[model samples]
Target: MVLAFSTESLNGLCSDDQLELLDAIDHLRLQGIDHYISLPQIIVCGDQSSGKSSVLEAISGVPFPVKSNLCTCFPTELVLRRTPETGVTVSIVPDSSYNSTENGLHKFHEELDGFEGFPDLVEKAKVAMGITTLGKAFSKDRLRVEITGPDRPHLTIIDMPGLIHSETKTQSKTDVRLVRQVVRSYMKQPRSIILAVVSAKNDFANQAVLNFAREVDERGSRTMGVITKPDCLVEGSGSEKAFISLARNNQVNFDLGWHVLKNLDSETQKGSSLLNQRNVEEARFFSRGAWKELPPSMLGINELRKRLSDVLLKQIAFELPSLIREIESGLDESREKLKELGEPRRTYDEQRLQLLQVSQGFQSLVEGSVSGSYDDPFFEDAQSDKGYEQRIRSVIQNMNKEFADEITAHGHRREVGSKSQTPDQNPEYVTREVFLDHVQSMMQRTRGQELPGIFSPLVVADLFRQQSSPWEEIARGHVKKAWDSAVKFLELVIEHVADPSISNSLLEKVIRPALKTLLTDAEVKTAELLKSHHRVHPITYNQEYAETIHFPGSHSREEISNIVRSFFGLSSISNGNQYLNNNNYNLSRLVDNLSKRVEPTTERLAASEALDRMLAYYYIALKRFIDGIAIEVIEQKILVPLSDILSPVAVFKMPAKVADLIAGESWESRSKRQDLTKKIDVLREGLGTCERFVSSRLKDEQNSQQEEAAGEDLDTSDLSVGIPTASDTEEAGVV
Candidate 1:
């Protein structure tokens, strides 16, 4: 499909079916249907000084304002309709974003008797679009000029801002970016058919239209190249060769192919009438030696319209289903947003209900989190990397396990030191000289105060104090970690369940204060629990101590009895007497060996029993402390009080300002809700129309195919009314 014209051309013979479809599409455009659902359309784009305005004037039969210095700064959507009367009107149709600014300024319009007043109207449009100062600026707002004439085609074309290369006094870098953004916005629409106009005078190297078109419409499937000013090419030059190559599709291939339209040159346009411009175009196409051999269908403005109409119809047929889908998707998204915003907040009762709902939801979340149910959505959201492990019950359970392990490990710290064997080899350990030294020190301090073998109460108290010194630090850390986790969980629950309107205030006025109080109370209670353990320095005997101290055999009893008697000097053992009588025995050396070996061993074994008794009782008390804090301090003081205090603060009495905020929607939110509702209606309506159109078109095509297969006459009853068998503008003139 290189589209090289043949000797004979297919001109003025396009089917009435194609023209009818274009007319129906134009009817929808006249109703402003594209604002709701994007329809397949022809959008003309080119660079500055690319003969874009000339081409538009030739195709549209309207004299657009063509300035030598400035390009059109806004999109101009020209909707041409063929009617019995001849008239034109220009109006500004702001985009959806401007719906709230529906003042008279945005709705301004002017009727025109002819093209004589159009240039001034364009200037006015510039000012209305906020380009009041002498600067290069553009707008996304559309200036729609509807022309109803006996000579107009049933077509809609949008003329976008021409791409600029560099900055000048009026146009800065911002203007360059602004133009590209504006043009790309239109070109990027999936349903837009890009009419990329390039001039034959410039080398294709400088033409950016082709590059932009390729960027958005890769493969050039929906882009049609319109080569204007073909007569401007010099004879026998590199530029001439490039123009011919593009026109012949030998370079830069396009699916729709290149179309060479010889519009009236500037000199010719000055003297020629709008009707005579066509005559001039035809004369040049036929008389020019370079273009004379090409097919008439591939030249001139008249054929371009017919070709565009055919292409637009086919495109509409192809994209209708997707357009419906897009519209439906938008509708669904709007509904979801409106749902999240909840029912309109307007009255006191409504506000009260909203607050109550939030409170109830928060309560449910807190309860679920502590109980580990995770039934509520808040906990469900917490099932992620961000401290999901910090759930109330989960954190407490893990901390308790870690605490028990820590305490168990601490009990064996002495045995695992450098001098001792591993616990697996033997669990028995001698506290030995450490306790003996403490008792001796106590005896020296309590001289003349206690009888022999009887420890002063002060000795027991000092030993207990030294052993239990680490409890306060450990208890404080445990309470703080658990409290912090509870507070964090509370914040998460509030954020998840409560509306933004109340979350901040509730946290400030209710949750934070109550949580602080609970933390204070828990800290005090924890200190007291550890203090109680330290206060009762009881040295009472117990069955566990007896079990810890008893030796299992008669040999252990006799050995212990001998060591006590020998060390106490109540008697020398018989073996020692036998060694003393031997001539090899030295009495002083024997005495030194007995004092070093025998006495320390006896004292060590006894000290080990006392140490074992003390630690056994201490370990039991530590286990009780861990359990008591978890139950009484963390759960009872912190977790329970947090929930109880928050309920009263959040549910019972809200501030007057907060009540008003919850009861009523903000102006911005109300505007957004209204806008969405309106757009939803528009989208739904457009979707219905497109659905019906597609259904009818498919049914007609099916019937036509069936009739041909069955050898019967085609049915044309369901199609639109057929137009006159003449040129589109000529048909308009006939009326």
Candidate 2:
């Protein structure tokens, strides 16, 4: 039934101030602020053919096309505004799930002065949204119908596509999921008051809308149950009684309670005065039947309209404060995004300046990181690996300590019994005696014209080279690890200081090549440091070497004596006097000759001496190598160059064309900046609107209190003296 437009029909339902508040929110919604923040509104949702569109039509007094077998395929938003004249405008708000440009959904708009062509407009909207019986079954796009008339209440009600129970030939499983997704998206908004429509012809338990409502608003704080088609139930039947109980809020109770309405039957819909006939039949059916027990507030479309209006107002009031806070937060985030994108670098000069700025920031952060001065906010998350990686000094120090420990534990080729071995000692180690036996074999093979006690000095160099072989691989690995950390830190700094487009170009054109060069230089320097020990003769003047050298105490005098006897093929004598008394030898002379003999024992002693010198030299060289890697290669070659890789001087020396290529904005960056700028503007305006609303509300409250105080001080005698009270002024039409 089409409701008439007149000034007296909808006036006094809400105060002018409340209407202003609703209008302000509506204005923000139209400006697309609702995409960033949820706005307060009534959303009608239910299963297919659940009379949801009927409820919307009853409240809005606009003819929403409804059929017995057909169901809504898209969301329809009815925005009713109170104005002096009647007007209507139809438009399409393209669903965010689809690209408006590709779909051409943003091009649909129509204006009308009346509702005569609304049904045809609805058909056109469906076609525009690509909804058809054989083709698309549903859409996420919204068909917005703004109705402005003198009698229309200031409200907005959205009628969403009904939920599907299962898939059919026309509606696939994808359509069912899409419809649920669309319904749940609206219900989940904190500011939306859910009007869950349930048809009385079906069992409430079978309907899924209430379950969805409870899922989103579990407490039912913002959900109201609306039972439609009450006249369809037979009087005094079990179904009618159950619906009556539901209308009384006894069955399936909600915090917002339940409402019931009777929509126009098919026969009544074809006749004139459809609104009057439907209202009369609904009232007559409820006035004397079991439904009479229900509250009047829960019956009829008029009371439902008032309840929805009040519910929306309270919801808006309850959410406005947090809404303002959300807008402020959104504004801050957009500004930060814009700042990260930086100023547009269109010209060569501007691009050069941008690169210089980025270079300055990169150099500053690198210097702080390399020097162990982690005072920057970026280094605050020290517990995280990213933060730890950025602290170059700490990472390098840990790496150096680990390198030294590895060398100490695995550096020696043999384990001497004289010294205790580390827990992590290399498994390839052999006893000193076994090592010396191998050394003696080598010595016999390389025996020069020299005496048995003396051997080639090259033997010591060979032993040292083999002992320190693991050093080069270990040092190279450590260097590579430190280089990786430096690269990670550089990438993080670039990302922080510049846009993605600029950062990617800078890394490709400048930072990567520079780092590659530094890595090669560091590796070469590390190899050179190892070469000095590998190719050259053992050389160390440190006094610590002399202190470290000690004879192998595990060797006994008997072992040496046995070796000497075996080498000369001599038998053991019963007494030492037998050899001394021989005419060929004198006692003192024989002892001196035995001590000076170039026997196998002399060769063993030479090997032992060589081993002791090698051990001492190894200790000294290990310390020197560790220091050289940490200081000369890691610090000087890699880290030191990193701090100046993107320095101001380097940026200044760069050609303008190269700087432009590295720092110029790309299409994505420009689009992102533009989007952020528009968002910032919308948020600022929304923030101002909320602030003005709050200020005006507070001023009104203060004025109300002051007037009440004045009224309280009034007396009969004061009125007689021609002093007008607030009530008196209002009665005289002066306020």
Candidate 3:
């Protein structure tokens, strides 16, 4: 039987106001809030017997309501599967009933069933649920039994008042309506997947009972329909196909919400629906022509039970593609309506595709480099270069070049070192400066230098590497191609710096901060994926990568631009607009590359995770921005304008040189029109200072942590140097 969950639609399942409710439920689930509403406390209400107590007995394993006319005089609650180790726990948030006269009565029946000396309860009870009482309430009398479970049993499911009592219309009394409401409210919880037992005989009164079930089953995801008396209704005629039709239709008749268990078999089967569904069908092939007329129970419940061992196992067996498609559709709708930021490029799928190509490409390249003559068709210089050089540089630049102190320190220092020399001083600094000075001395040579840093050893060294491979020297006379590629990158860099809009000062200001922030943020986010337990290894993590998306901020142009500004501050004096656009593009590319390396499953997986992560991070980034702006706002509002504010480290932005190279000569003029090149140079200067402070803070934090971790006699040397210090940086960049 389809179990009737199929007809239920999750459409409009959650209202806007219910978002918080849903979120809260999702939160409880995360916390494993396995809580079920408890009862005497939970008086199930339905007219007459309505099989209410049968549900209670089945769920709680305690019998009640011997017949239809009998009132469970004691108002007893059966306890299911319990022990004494874990205390009985319940949560009761009372429903508002202050104005009702019924609320005035203190309903306590004083052990009417067993309390020998207690008086009967009034219409209502003064006893209430509180921190001290939790949800427990004491009645003067009536049936009340509490069972504690072995472990903290995941929540409680209570069967309250039987449908239609002798004295009350609701299974619960009017005085207990507040309590009933509370129980119903708890059942509505999003994580509380409910299995509501309904009578299958299909009577008008029983149908009303199903209506209540429908009303309570608001969340399509949480409600399931369970028909109890199949033996009476379909008898042996209920074949699997027939039962599935009936089971699947129950939701239609009963109003259960969406989310059908795909598998026909739910967790447990109380009766023997399978005897005929399975064995009867199987037995039909044998000499069962006469036996077909017999009920399996005629033989024995055990034999009937044996007929259903495998067939009765409750499993969700719907086609997975449907579920996946449904989820994806829901995700898309959610994304469009859910959050603040709308990023078309928010997905890492394209990036993942690129990474896949690169990963496979790099492996191929490495194998090619190592290939012996015997290896498959080795070419002296097999690389295709029409666009090969450009693509290579593109990948490297896309890798995001970092200019840590150590990087610049590499070729910085001059041949002449003063006594102030620290072994860690960057050699790049001295050498590059010397090269610059030499060019100036040969100012006559500057006319030919074409570029300010044209003769610099840094460029010369790069030039050399591109020309010679470990295995061969620029075979096929590709020397010009390599030189041309190098020259192209150089031109891109020089033109960007020389742009009139870029002042050395502003360049100094924005360059370091933006780039540093971008790269580091990307790294941190990428690291989060790598850190996920699902990742088998760092490199292999890419194989398992997926993307998620959500909006974090408004789609308003101004608001979005502001987010961009807060994230990638412009470097120029005017802080032109194009720079912002260009920066965004580059940052996106870089973020994508890094993210893909962390998780590179496939197009679909990439899109999903990229979207989720974007939503998560954008929220975080916006929060950071708000905090930062708030600090400034508070400072502005205060009597004393804040003299000090924590300036977060600027992540590495796409370098202007690289951006220029990407733009090409023509793309440069228009692309960098408002670009801030020289301004970024100043940013670099500020970054130097920021780096120093951050480094000091990091060192202090490390030292403090180490000291705390150390014993009284611990040696300083006992602490191993971990992450390289700010000034003392490590070099891991591509050559």
Assess candidate 1 and give its TM-score to the true structure.
0.68
Work out the TM-score per prediction.
0.68, 0.67, 0.24
In the range 110-208, model 2's lDDT, one tens digit per residue, is: 888766776677778888888876678888898888888676667677889889999988789999999999999999998898999999989998999
lDDT of 3 by residue, 500-615 (tens): 23323223443334333433433343334223311221111222122212221122223344555466674311332244444534444333333342223343232333233332
lDDT of 3: 0.31
lDDT score, residue 545, model 2?
Answer: 73
For 650-676, candidate 1 gives per-residue lDDT tens digits of 655876566765446778777777877
Candidate 2 lDDT (Cα, 0 to 1): 0.77
Best by lDDT: 2
Q: Considering only N, C-alpha and C atoms within 3 Å, which residue pairs clash in candidate 2?
A: none
